[model samples]
Target: MSPTTDADLSDFVFVRRNDGLPIEEIPFELVERKGVGHPDTMCDAIAERASRYYSQYCLEHFGRIAHHWFDKVMLFGGESDLDYGHGELVNPYTVLFAGKGAHRCGDTPIPLADILRRAAADVLSEVTTGFDADRHLVIDCRIVDHQGAGRGRSRYRPESHDDLVAIGDPSLVSNDCNLLHAFAPFSRLEQAVLRIERLINGPDFKARHRDTGWDVKVFGSRNGEDFSFIVNMPFLASDISSFDHYLSRKAECREEVVGLLRDTLGGDPAVLFNPTDRNGRPYLTALGSVADTGDVGAVGRGNRVTGLITPMRAMSIEAPAGKNPLDHTGKLYGVLAQQLARRLNEMTGKPVETHLFTSKEAPLDRPDQVVVRVHGLQDGGDEEQKIRAVVAEALANTAELTREIIVTGVTMW
Candidate 1:
């Protein structure tokens, strides 16, 4: 049958079922309650620092043309899986980097492994005061051998043997304590998102984005269930009549999407939209969930007050634009960090610190169009109310700052 405006899209929607439970009844005590020194915290620090360093290095060396020479840098962080049955927690150490021209780092070989290891050690040392030297943290870097002995193809292959090197660890952690403790807060984020999705879309609404591919699965409470969402929106300039028509079309499409989502999973129906509309804006949304919640209650109930949702905006300025994209990204990130920290503190009635990162990628086709990635972090409490407030503030500030930047006519080419 031809797809109709009201036709259910459930067939296209994906579902993942498991014995895993939703975060609903999970006691709040199961979540870890530490502020810093958490594995996720450490990962955030490392990823931010590494991305910032890479961005700066590119700017200093390539100037306005840096984006043409850059690539993706994957930001990897988090702990190992926990073996609850065995009463052991395997604290997982991960290495994620992103950059442009990642496939062509075979020439002018850079010591990527060394850089990653150093970065990890520095991060660990900075986070862990008086860390036990006896507990040696093994940090290794190696190329991802995806092709099984030449039988498979590598996901990322350097164009020249002299390009940059790829580094990571193969030894996954194996432990007994609830490794979930290390990732409880993140789990809460997942729960909040899932609840919201189900409320607006339906219970069957599954996350459609992943690191490797576009796969859809229901939010679960088990290993490999952490959820994250990314929304990409575009602004357009059009007549009011056209804009109304566009909104109508968007609303119809959104309803169909949510209807299909509910049919697949049996969730409640709800819709979330930006309070303000943008002209010609295209949006992308991503979701992730955690599988375990060992200390959910201890940390705090997943209240909106303690949860936060923030968006980090990035723009690329091509060469000959009379500005450096890298420098501009750094400056913007700094501004975001400072502003977010102040705003979060005021909203939460608690002192807060913000983290920021800048990343660059080399243009494969357009040598002049440099791409800059900016990441920002804002702290929220463990309650739902607090989290929601933080997210609201962050989003408001981000939108304002983005508008200001565009109006100032700043360029980082």
Candidate 2:
């Protein structure tokens, strides 16, 4: 597809709605974020990294990305024992790699299982320090070579590079019917929740506080201008000396988080940590994540592509993790919707929600319908024209979008 011109604008719909209230003023808003080491987030990370490695291999060897989607990963937690100053994982965690991928191009075989295992190890090592991936993690590959539902066998089991349709037509064709919806200009409470999570998981915070674990979950609710958070943060058992020490460390961490939230939201918000803590029991873990024990997680159950699950704003049920970066509308459209909404919001100085819809085999650049809604829009004519330009340009440059997703490892969790 060529650069978008005036003619390309006709395919999209742009409207201005002034009735919808901004998220903060809407009375009741809810947002949840699963941190880096949460089991669900772990599955998302492993699956997406697996896809990235697979795509890179295909591009380096065959000059194009082969068909692959590893979005069905699962992490089954292992058995563990923990005390105030001692912890150990007796059984290793098991990561099951599911979905399908092209295993060969003509006679050249692809080492897909090895690539996936390496990807899992790389991500797991970065997220946890108590467990060694080579010794304490088991990587299993149940990924197959068959495309599900209506697609033919050759799609995932292609015999040659010529069978990879996307290689011939750089403007990839959508593999499924999907909808992508996203909004921009996060409210004060939403921004505060994100900032709090980052503050706790950041490197500087980790350096100062060694007792804190990575399996943090932040849940925030806002009623009008008042915001409150219930955070599930785990403490490393090996770092705490006694019950009093655990309580003291938690108090310090809570103070730091509340300070950050007050600065970000410009108000005093209530922050609670480990509500389940009792007289002699606290939230403690061996490997920083609950997954070091018997807890399990599956993909598509964690945070959305924006890194938070916001029910108050426009959201999609679709999960973008592990989908092919080239032709999978499930991944591409979601990422693009976010970018478009932010651009329009910045341009119009109003909140924006972008929705893109497409069907099976549709061209990547052209969706079946494109809807751009500007909340609290001041005027229509010229603003709508500008919105159309943004949509048209995005639709015309999907090839570049795919490249960015592959190279940068676009955020899906």
Candidate 3:
């Protein structure tokens, strides 16, 4: 059964459908989660933090978040030499920050350099342990003041703080034509992967096992009832004394993770930790991350807003990080779709998927399409009405959504 078009309004075409398959019922599923210390994720984190800091600075000085976009960020891994028990950084990691931002409000400077440095330092410190951003990383700022071609003029280089007052538009509009999809109730396998990674990176596990590194990636595949996970986790070189010591630590960590999987799924799932480990070489690093070991990364190449990269599910290719919180539907709609999906699911007690799309420069509250798929949608006629009411209410409150995003620093990558 396919979903039917329920309501077609002027601003949005709402489609409510049944026969949507739950993720678990889907025969095959693939979910990947890039850990915080992964270079790509690191870039996303830094970009988002920078945007938040920039927003705060503008709000404090100009009374609103000025027009800016800091989505382009790259982490060029440094060179590091490693052995069984020792590691040395030959060169420091380079964080190349490239994007457009508000450099000045009239004659007053926005202190972009100070904002970027603070953002990068804070994120790097939080993501990795035993690593100092100042000592082990170089910050490069290539941000400029410019907007796209048809945007009238360069809002980034505004004439005065007064010019920035209208930058946060009262009528929030989409900056780009983009689509976002989100669903509620993560599948059991998805939950398992999230839990496993959180455990590995959490403080208690880090305290218990000092050799574990934070640069972890979990790839989970499910075919029918059987599930398997390939976790690429790094081991700190300084914690291992010899080959035997490395094996012992690796074995211990694997056992713990296996136990976690078993507990999560209520079944023994096949688990492999650091499958790339060989005799002469191990998945070892100095600062608990491959980002400092010649591995490069950029934004939009990592996880989606839901924190997992699920190729099997409805997804958007847009990277939401660093976009302005006020009107960029790339960021706002992505977060809104997920929130609406969760709320609808909770309200109807059914698996719900929400997709929102808009045209470039369209009002944020007026999306071109809002497709809601409820697994048991056919059971009730009022469900469609409820869905419309919910979506309409949420859309009407997009201003609040923007405020929430700025205040909470909602995660979207």
TM-score of each: 0.27, 0.96, 0.94
Q: Write candidate 3's Cα lDDT for 243-328 as tens digits.
A: 78887888999999999988778688998888887656778898778986789999889999999998888988889888888778
Residue runs of model 3 more than 4 Å from their true location after superposition: 1-13, 165-168
* Residue ranges of candidate 2 with Cα displaced over 4 Å: 4-8, 147-153, 165-171
What does the lDDT come to for candidate 3? 0.83
Please write out the lDDT profile of model 2 over residues 75-158, one tens digit for every residue: 999887898788888899999998888888778999987998888888777777666876788888888887788876778878
Residues 1-413, candidate 1: write the lDDT tens digits.
11212122222111111123323333321211112233333444344344344434433433211221111222233232322111111332344433322222334334445555565567655433223222324453333323324321222343443222211111111111110000122334344443433333222322221110111122222223332232111111111134455466446444654564366434533434322346444221111111111111111111111222211111111111111122233333434444544555455453333333223421111111111111122224243234334433442343344334333432211
> Compared to the true structure, candidate 1 yields what TM-score?
0.27
lDDT of each: 0.29, 0.83, 0.83
Residue 306 shift from truth in candidate 2, angstroms = 1.2
Ranking by TM-score: 2, 3, 1
TM-score of 3: 0.94
List the pairs of residues colliding in candidate 2.
Answer: 106-159
